[model samples]
Target: MDNANTWFDYIPFNSRGKVGKISVLLLLIAVGLSDFVSASILKPYFERLRPSHSELEGLILLVNKGGKYGFVSSHAANIFAASTILSFFYIHKKKLCLTIAFLVSYSRIYVGVHFPGDVIFGGMLGYLIAIITITFYSKFVLNKNKKKLIG
Candidate 1:
């Protein structure tokens, strides 16, 4: 497998269905925005610090240290949002996306970038945002033309 392809391999950009394509794009954007809001807004509001910066000791980092605030991890939020949105579109792809999401969230904790609470809250925020995005898309785009790919 090519190294660059590794980053591009998972997303099914050329997949069939208009709704599926639009859903992926919109959901991705929503998740990205959600991550931004959580990282920038909520993190400042919560005023949390990363485990590495805090009083914690003896951490083994698989990756580089992360930003200051660890509450509501952006990785967890974005991945979960992508996973949830993809799951809604293609039932067969649900397990893969969700499994990846969980792994990504766990990796944050393992790398000492976030606590379990941070990962969980971030995932929750992402999931909620995805739900709202899907509902809005369904109401405005899907139902506007009375099209059905999935609910």
Candidate 2:
């Protein structure tokens, strides 16, 4: 487990084992793909604007293009998705993963790209996707180890 932790931390620096590298790559790809699909497919359908562009006009701190749709924040969705998957692999560091997830989601609103509601919804969607993926992986890929541990 210590080796796994070491590898996890060093994966981006080219000091990780093959499994760790593969895990990180998969997590990134999954999150990226999900975020892209959510933004492209769902954002247009929802077509909601940020608070800065809404009736709350002066209440929001406008820093960017505020009139654009902001239903599902891509930043929030992608980071949440990555964090969720990391949490499953780093169960002992669950709190850290969650904290990072919160920060990532909050950054979207702080940067004026999305509303609070957008981050909230995106995080939820990301979490659901992570749960489904993790469940499938555990049930199939880790089934043998699970039975052995249980038995």
- TM-scores for every candidate against the unseen true structure: 0.87, 0.73
In model 2, the clashing pairs are none
Highest TM-score scorer: 1
User: What C-alpha lDDT values do all the predictions have?
Assistant: 0.83, 0.74
lDDT of 1 by residue, 63-119 (tens): 777777888898899988888888888778888889999999998898778999999
For model 1 the local lDDT of residue 115 reads 90
**lDDT for model 2:** 0.74
Expressed as tens digits, the lDDT of each residue in 1-151 for candidate 2 is: 4677666563343436755664576577668666776788888899887666677645656466644788887777777778788777667767887898899889878867777989998888788777777776668867977888999
CA RMSD of all predictions: 3.3, 5.7
